[model samples]
Target: MRHTLTLFVTLTVFWLLNSGHNTVLMTLLGLVSIIFVLYVAHKMDVVDHESQPVHLSLKFPGYFLWLLKELVLANISVVKSIWLGNSTISPCLMTIKSSQKTDLGIVIYANSITITPGTVSVDLIGDRITVHSLFKENIEFLKAGEMDRRVTELES
Candidate 1:
């Protein structure tokens, strides 16, 4: 019930924000759209925690900020490597154990690694994730476990 309400409210807010119309017609249309979506979601039986993820609302902002900072640092590192030529690059494919217990947490961590400029999540097998990094430094950054800890916190 709570998840359903959360999903409804979230979808409605998104509709209003994205629609950018405050008139009666737009408001009514948005309300109808939200109701139709809720109806379909109810029929689909996906109005659950995995679908809505309301629990992640508060934690995700901080994680996003941290990830943005990491991306900037990674971008700088990549540019520096380019300027210094390919000699500075030491590409490696390695597997690391996932500290997250939930599939959502592991996915967020993997996507975060993949989007961070110099590293990509190649595969996830069981609790281990295979990562390909453009430099040894990027691998060391992942091995430090800071992003893993932050993502685990977001999920839990």
Candidate 2:
């Protein structure tokens, strides 16, 4: 019941914030839609309580700052390599270990890796992730385990 209420409230807030125009009827309609969604979710039994860990807390601001810095650095490196006009990009496949204990955490970590520039997660099995990096330096960074460590910390 708590999860359902949380989902409904989240959806309602998202709709209200995103809507350009405000109207009493529209707000009531949005609330109704949110309730309908919750009803459907309840009927489907797709909301796994086990997946929502109560103790999990992420330092989102720090993670976002770190991610932004890494993105900027990656963009600079890619631009430099492109301007050099040589085959400076070295593609390599490497495996990294994931320290996240939950399946959802592992999925998030893998997806985050794929979302970042210069690297792609090709496969994930158990705690191992196969990543394809555009450069050997990127592979080395992964092997250094900094990314994995940060993701594990976030998962916790």
Candidate 3:
């Protein structure tokens, strides 16, 4: 029930922010859209813990900020490598261990790796995520598991 209400409120706020119109007709239309989305989501049975993720709500903002910082640093590295030439981009594939206990945490960790420039989470099996990195240095950074540790923090 709490998750459902949270979803509804989040959807409404998202709609209002994106629409930018507060007229009665616009509000009604937005409400209708929110209801339809909520119905479909409920029918699909995707409103459970993994999907709703209320437990991680408070911690997500901090994680997001950290991700943003990592993303910027990665972008700089990629750009520098590009400027240095294609020879500087040494691609490699390797698997890194994930310590997260929950599916959501694992997914978040894998996605964080993917979202950061110069790395892609190719496959996740058991506690390992196979990653393709654009540079050898990126693989080394991933192997350090700082991002994995940060995401695991969100789970608990």
Cα lDDT of candidate 1 equals 0.90
Once fitted onto the true fold, the runs of candidate 1 whose alpha carbons sit more than 4 angstroms away are none
Number of clashes in every candidate structure? 0, 0, 0
Residue 143, model 1: Cα distance from true site in angstroms:
1.6
What stretches of model 3 exceed 4 Å from their correct place?
none
Estimate, for each residue in 1-156, the C-alpha lDDT of model 1 and write its tens digit. Answer: 999899888988899889888999999989898999999999999998888887898888888988999899999999999999989999999999889998888888889999999999999998899999999888887899888888888898
TM-score of each: 0.89, 0.86, 0.90
Candidate 1 C-alpha RMSD relative to the actual structure: 1.7
lDDT per residue (tens digit) for residues 1-156 in model 2: 666656666678889898866889988888788878878887888655443343343475686688788888887887898888668888899888988888877887788788778889999889999999888998888788787788788777
Clashing pairs in 3: none
Top candidate on lDDT is: 3
